[model samples]
Target chain A: MDTFVQQLINGLTIGSIYALIALGYTMVYGILRLINFAHGDIYMVGAYAGLFLATSLGFAANPSAFGFVVTLVGSMAIAAAMGMAIERFAYRPVRKFSKMTTLITAIGMSLLIEYLFVFFFEGKPRSFPQLLPNDNITLFGNATISTSQILIFVVSMVLMVILQYIIYKTKIGKAMRAVSFNLNSAKLMGINTDFVIAFTFALGSALAAAGGVLTAQYNPKIDPLMGIITGLKAFVAAVLGGIGNIPGAVLGGLLIGAAETMVVGYGSYIGIPSTYRDAVAFAILILVLLLRPAGLLGSNVQEKV
Target chain B: MNWVKSIIVGIIAIAILYVLNAAMSATGFFGIGIDDYQSRLLVFIAINVILATSLNLINGFTGQFSIGHAGFMAVGAYASAYFTVTHGKAIETSLSGLGETVASSIVLLLAIGIGALVAAIAGLIVGIPSLRLKGDYLAIVTLGFAEIIRIVILNIDAVGGATGYQVPGYANFLWIGIFAIITVVVIHNIVKSDAGRALISIREDELAAEAMGVNVTRYKVTSFVIGSAFAGVSGVLFAHYNKFLSTNDFQFIKSFEIIIMIVIGGMGSMTGAILGAIIVTLLPEILRLLPAIQIGETTFQFADLRLVIFALILILTMILRPQGILGTTEFTDFFKRFRRADKPTGGLE
Candidate 1:
């Protein structure tokens, strides 16, 4: 029972990060109808940005709540600017072309970011500087949770709430919704669709960056290619919850994360080795796609003639 | 008369292949030597042509977006490699009376057959269920399936698992070139046939095709399976010729490279696929020849930035020529247009 609780906690902590990243995928996909494959690399960039800020600004030398906050916000700002820049340059030019073209461009953007980073920073993994004092607190029945895990959960929840507030209670969020509903209509109604799209990318990229930083906190190893698998799984989560649905993305993330941890935790009894952990997300995805093609929370719209 | 012409063409093709094979051998034909590197490049181009054209059948002609092609390729490569490693020696020994070349050729044929059959079955299994979804969903599902296939292969120890698999090299440039040609001819004929029209219609408008009584599911699955089978064939040729099998070689990036080929060459254009295959195969080598730049204390190698340059090229291509270089037009069509001075037609519309 304790192990199950422990696994569940670990799963949810990771799930929250997936949810943060999934939000970005879901948002970009909502308005643009493009996967924005480079969004994952944006997450990696965010962690790297945070690392640079922490080290250069002397925050890594003395860990504090203020230091962590500054590093988090600083990286988020950097990643947001990058997101907007990417949309303006790479994506904007190809936006008018076929869906395949935009997708390919996005893929190209992803490769460019990954390899450029590899070219500059090298492919070796770097340990992210610990930004918080580490400690474990026992809950009950020998179950324990670490400080970094708690930070991931708390920070993600706070950011998600802020995101919710922005979407529901702000004018730009309203514009974002209008644009996603119909780009042409939104433009006709005097909403700046381009700005909205860029804002969406900024918002999504910021959230993803947050996820990246949070993940680094929990597991400090940061690498250029780390985003590929995590980003893919998060994209899967977005799809599993219905791609464009915001709440659905969160639900999908948690479900996927829990399922992955459970596979690692209990799969040995079912003859599944822990090495199959990476495959677990995809397996669940296929099953979900087969049963619920529109996703769990996605509405099935009738095909128009 | 048609049968006689085709027979003659067949004989000529075989003769050309035989001469080409001899020329590429260590001891050259007429003392003119083809270097190992050049021959290897030619062989890879042939394999990639098969891959691109087959993938084009599914993604371009059929309008079904499948990015899991390498998964099918891996299946074929590993299955055939396993067969060749375990039973190949026995089969070769039994057929040795026919001569060494004939015995090895027989073994390779059997391996290719097994590879194609197994990959086709995998295609059927994956295609039947996943083809029901549309567009991005389909793409993600295919990607997921490919990852799953890779992970599963990674776990299986009999095929050397993560250590990589070694196999007998039963394939040569001749066999690979023949299969590449066969794949192109078969796929081109399919695109030109009534069923090809059905596939094109599905790509253009799925609902309209369904309204017109096209068995949408069947044709989609059929094209997908055929594409996967050809991918499998390429895998077989690749495994036997390369004499090495690694799951790393069949990763998502490889699938993306195949997509890049068809995209750059012009999707739905057979010649474009071939052209794209050649360029993609050669681009890296060309990039490797680039001079290094010395700046201050650091020397930057252009070879190391080949992938970065490649990505930039892909992005630029998508922006500048979103419809691709050929835009669904055949290479011969360019000549026809030049002769007649007529407006070129036939693309997505």
Candidate 2:
């Protein structure tokens, strides 16, 4: 019982990170309908930026609560700018072309970013500086948890709430959503669809950066190539939750994270190695796509002839 | 008349390749059997042709973009490798494996057959779920699926785990050529068939194709499966030829590279696949000879510059000639004569 509860808590913590990154995927996909393969690399850039600020900027080996918050904000700012540039330069012009062409261009951008990082940063993994305390607080009789995990969940929820406020309460948010619903109509309404699209990418990318920082806190390691799988997994989560649905992305991320944890925990009982955890995620992805192509929370927009 | 010209053009191209292959083998340039390198080049070209062409079937012809060709190849590689490693020698021994008996031939056939069979099964499994999704969603799912296959294979201790599995080194130029020929022949035949027309119609417009008595979902699934089956067969050749195969070799990077071939070649053309594959493969080798120069004792080899140059080429190609070198036109189509009416000679002077 304790193990289940513990696993559940850890899964939720990680799932929040997935949810944060997945928000970016779902948002871009909503308006642009392009996967933004570079979104993952953007998250990676966020983590590295956070790492740079924390270490190079004379923050103590162990940071106070204020220091951690500042580093997180700075990293997210850089990531958001990077995301906006990627959309403006690589994606905006190609928007008029075929989806395949845009997709290929996105892939090129992805590879270009990933490889450039490798060349510049030297392809070795670096230990992330520890800012929070290492002590774990015992919750139940046998279940223990860490402050870092709590921080991840708390920060992600706060961000999501803030994002909700922006998306639902702001004029720009409504414009973004309107464009996603129908670009032709939005353009006719003088929405400046391009600016709205770029803004959406920036906002989503900033969220991913926050997720990257929080993840680094938990894992305490960051590498140039760190964003590849996590980015892909988050994309899967977005799709699983329904591509354009906001709440759905969060739900999908949490489900995948919890399911993955359960597979790791339970597979041990059945003598299956926990190393196959990644495979478990994809297997679930396939199942989701096969069972409900519209996604769990997504509505079908019928294909036009 | 068009078919006759296509057949004649095909024969002539094959004849040219055979002569070029023979000459390269005889030259023995760089002291390593030049012919062997050429044969290896041919093998790379052939495997790539199979990959790019099959992927084009889905991506270009059927308008369904799939990025999981490597997953199918992995399935085939492991299957064929398992066959040859487990059963090849044993069967060979039982059927006069120790002697110069013709029974060894039977074992050889079984290995290739078993390899292709296992790959086909994998194709069917992958294709079923593919029926539900469309475009980029399906591409991501397939990419994720391929990555999963790689990771799973890496973890499977029954195979070589991360180290990769080894198969008997029995595959050669002859066997590769034969299979390559068969793949091209079969695909070419299929492309000209009613099924090909149906596939093209889907590419033009999926909804329109569906409304016009074509079963859209069925055709998509069918072509996807068939394409995957060819990917499997190529994997078998790769496994047997390379001897040692690692899970990393079947990564998403490889699938992307194959996609580059399809994109750089004309998407739906067979000759484009062949040309794109050969050009992309040979580009690196050709780049190696680009005369390394030193900038103030900091020597930079052409090999080091290859990736940057290659990326530039890809970008330029995408921008300038998105239809690829041949576009939709086949090599045979170029040679077709166009009648030119005689110009009026200065008012009938």
The candidate scoring highest on DockQ is 1
The 0-to-1 C-alpha lDDT of every candidate, in the order given, reads 0.91, 0.81
Candidate 1 lDDT, tens digit per residue, A1-305? 99999999999988998899999999999999999889889999999999999999999999999999999999999999999999999999989987878888988899899999999899999999899999999999989999999999889989999999999899999999999889999999999899999999999999999998999999999999999889989998998999899999999999889999999999999999988998888887888888886789998778667
Per-residue lDDT tens digits of candidate 2, residues A7-102?
Answer: 898888888999999999999999988998889888889999998999887664767887798889999999999999988877776788788878
> Candidate 1 docking: what grade?
medium
Name the lDDT value of residue A56 in candidate 1. Answer: 99
The candidate scoring highest on TM-score is 1
lDDT of 1: 0.91
Q: Which residue segments of model 2 deviate by more than 4 Å?
A: A60-62, A270-272, B1-39, B93-108, B287-321, B337-349
Model 2, B1-349: lDDT tens digits are 4345546655665665565555555653443345566678778877887787778777877878898899988888887778778878877778784573456556556766776677667777777776568778788888987887788778877778977687777765556666666677667767777898899898888878988999988888888888888888888888888888998888777888887787788788888887778877888889788888778956656665444555555555665676777878887666544534464323311
TM-score of chain A of each: 0.99, 0.97
Clashing pairs in 1: none
Could you give candidate 1's per-residue lDDT for residues B1-349 as a string of tens digits? 3335445654677678778888886677987868899889999999999999999999989999898999999999999999999999999999999999999999999999999999999999999999998877788788888888889999999999999999999999889988887887788778877899999999989999999999999999999999999999999999999999989998878888888889889888988999999998998898778888899988888878867877887898898988678889986666764664476554633
Clashing pairs in 2: B25-B35
